[model samples]
Structure formats: C-alpha cells, structure tokens
Target: MMIQKQYKFYAAHRNEELNDKCSNLHGHRYGVTCFFEVERTGSLTTLFADFDDSIEPHLKREYDHAMMIHVKDPLYQTLLRHMKETGETLRLKCFSCPTTVENLAHQLFTEITEMGFRLNRLEIRETDTSVVSYTREDWVNDNRYFASYQIPPSESVS
Candidate 1:
C-alpha cells in the first residue's frame, strides 16, 4: 500500500555565486509531498502507516521556516557551529548546506530512512508549476553500485 502526505514550510536562501536574481537572498513558501510504500506485516486495522504519527514532526522541525544553508558556505559553517555550541535554535533558511529542492529531498529522504521508515518517493514544489522528485530507487542506484553477491545454502554447496 502507498500513503502520501503534504507539508509546507517558508524558507529563504540563495545561490551565493549564481550571479542572477536568485543569488540575492529570497524566500519561498514551499510545499513537499512524500509518498511512502508500505509492506504488510500481516497486521490488522491498518492499510498503511499513519502519516501524522510517522512523518509530521520531522518535517516541521527540519524544514519549516528554517534557513537552508549550503555546507560549503563558510559563513553558514561558522554560524552552524556556534548554534551547536550554544544550543540555539537556528534561523529559518539559515542552513549549513545548500537549500535547493534536490538537496532538500536528498536530506529529507535520508532523515526519514534513518528514522526507521522506508521512503518510497519525495516531491518538492518550489512553486505551483515547478517541482522535483526523488525516488528511493534512484538513491540506491546513483552510480555507487557494488558487485552483487549471494550465499548458497550449505546443502546445495556440498
């Protein structure tokens, strides 16, 4: 079964060296939709996991009204370290990493997966007509393939 949920956050960011209008700091009211594919564990009374219970809180804290900074930005790097040292809540869009839709989806996918939930797909909308999606399959197959291996049963090997 597949379950989907939508979230919104307001954030600001810029490509520091893009040399375009986008290089000037700006904000957007962004929307993100996540689709989760669930495999049945043969449990009763559930078609899929609860979106509220599984996904909402993480979205709120990590993305909502937060600055999306680039990890390589020296200023952002310094501020992030200061925040860590002082335990201060960071300003929205004040991130230590780039805040592009691709990066956002990548980061969110990792976060959700690490939280013990399988993320099937992620859709990030920067505007009503502009959208980007990242699928779990894409992540697993992103030029990092290793040789496949399998173990045969002991009896079959004998």
Candidate 2:
C-alpha cells in the first residue's frame, strides 16, 4: 500500500549563481508532498504513516517563516553585519545548503529518511505551476551515491 502527505512552509531565499533578477531575495509558500511505501502492520492496519506524527511538526519547525541562505552567500555576512551594527535580533533560520527547489527536495528527503518513513517519491513545488519530483530510485542512482548532502571536509564548519 502507499500513503501520502502534503506539507507546506513559507521561506525566503536567493540564488546567486543565476544571472537574472533571482539575484534578489524572494519568498515562497512552498509545498512538499511525499509518497510513502508501506505494508500492513502487525494484526493488519492499513495505516502506514501518520502525517501529524511523522511529518508536520518537523516541517513547521525547519521552514515556517524561515530564511534559507547558502553558507557561501555574501548576504549571510551582510546579515551578520546588520546585526552587529544595530544589535537587532535576526530570527531567520539559516540553512547550510543552497535554497533552490532541487536542494529543498534533497533536504526534505534527508529529513524524511531520518524519521524512518519509507518514502517512494518527493515532490517539491516552488509555485503552483513549478515543481520538481524525485524518486527514491533516483537517489540510489545519483553519482554521489546518496551522499549528495554531505558537506565536504574542506567546507565543514569548525
């Protein structure tokens, strides 16, 4: 059997590698839907994963109203400068990885796997019309051999 859940989060980010206006900061009401593969448990309940227990809380914490800033982004330092100059509280949650939709999919995949849910597919939608999907099989076939999210030793924070 297969069970699915859809989750949402509001976040802001920018992509510096791009040549267009995306170089400016922007926000999105991102949507993520995960498909889970499951088997009947024990005496025979069809339920495999609970949305509230397995997913929602984590999404709410990691992304809701958060800022996704790549570590190499200069804005990262700019934000720090502003904080130091103004003594203001910067409540934004900074992500260690780039904030593109593809990276978001990878981030969510890592989280879902760590939570022990058996996932079949993950769909990350940047907008109502723009979306990207990744299957578990795709991750297995990736050249990085599923270690795509690892921080290289030279880049690791001290």
Candidate 3:
C-alpha cells in the first residue's frame, strides 16, 4: 500500500531558534525519501505522481543548491548582502521558523499533501546514514491504533 522514492539535493542552512552549531551557515548533501500510497484509480494519471516530471522540477528548483534562511535570523541579511554584492543569484528558500531537519520534512510533507498525493511518510537524511522519518501518524491529530494482524511471523525477524 506504500511506495517511496528517494531523492538527493544540496542545501545551505542554519537553525536560528535552536542556537546549535547548525546556527552557522553550512551546506550538506541531503537525501529525502518520499512515501506515497498506491491509488488503484490515481488522481493524476497511471500512478500517484511522476518523480521526474512532477515532483522533480518543483522540489529540485527550490532546494538544489539553495540556502534556507529564517527572516528573523541576522545571517539572513548577511546572505542577502553577499548575494547582492556578488551579483550571483543563489537559490534561496526562506522559512518563517528555524530550518531544522524535522521542519524541512514537515514542510515538504505539507506541500506534497497539498498537491493531492496521499503522502504516507517522509524520511530526510543529512547524510546517507543519518535519517529522520515522519508520517501523519507521527503527529497528534492523525494518531490512531493499527488493527493487529494475525499473519505468520516473518522468518527474517525470527
């Protein structure tokens, strides 16, 4: 019932609210796993959404080589000034709150959901090994108990 696609992008960001070392402007190669539920009768066409044609252009254009900045952050001005002085148009995405991994995941999840995709989950990784996963079940309003399955146990787990 669930399907996923992984994507890669590079970005610069600093988390002002947390005041952690991430408070410093830096870049990272990010990995994101987008999850969707199969629609036997999909809304778009044959499938839920096209990665290359649909999601790619929208997400890649905003995130690839982009800088994430909160408007309240002092570094926001610095980055703007630098861009103005250098005459280099850097891809920048501004957030109202701190740019944390969790926040970014939620942001993407919201956008994808608005696009009419039944987003099941989202996994964000700053590195290949470091990952954070999110789902509607992760938040309070969407929480519910899953019906216990009586299927046989998997050999892999045993």
TM-score per model over all chains: 0.71, 0.82, 0.76
Each model's lDDT: 0.65, 0.74, 0.70
The residue-by-residue lDDT of candidate 2 on 45-78, one tens digit each, is 4443465576887777667776777777889888
Per lDDT, what order, best first? 2, 3, 1
Identify the runs in model 3 with alpha carbons over 4 angstroms from their true place. 18-20, 42-49, 84-86, 139-158
Arrange candidates by TM-score, descending. Answer: 2, 3, 1
Judge candidate 1 against the unseen true structure and give its global Cα lDDT, from 0 to 1. 0.65
Query: Candidates 1 and 2: which is better by TM-score?
Result: 2
> Which window of ten consecutive residues has the lowest lDDT sum in model 3?
149-158
Model 1 spans with C-alpha error above 4 angstroms: 41-49, 74-89, 92-97, 141-158
Residues 24-143, model 3: lDDT tens digits: 789889888888886556654345346546677766777888887766688877777887899877677876556778767767776677677778888999876789889877632322
lDDT at position 136, candidate 1: 93
In candidate 2, list every pair of residues with a backbone clash.
none
User: Which wins on TM-score, candidate 2 or candidate 3?
Assistant: 2
Question: Where is model 2 more than 4 Å wrong at Cα?
Answer: 42-49, 141-158
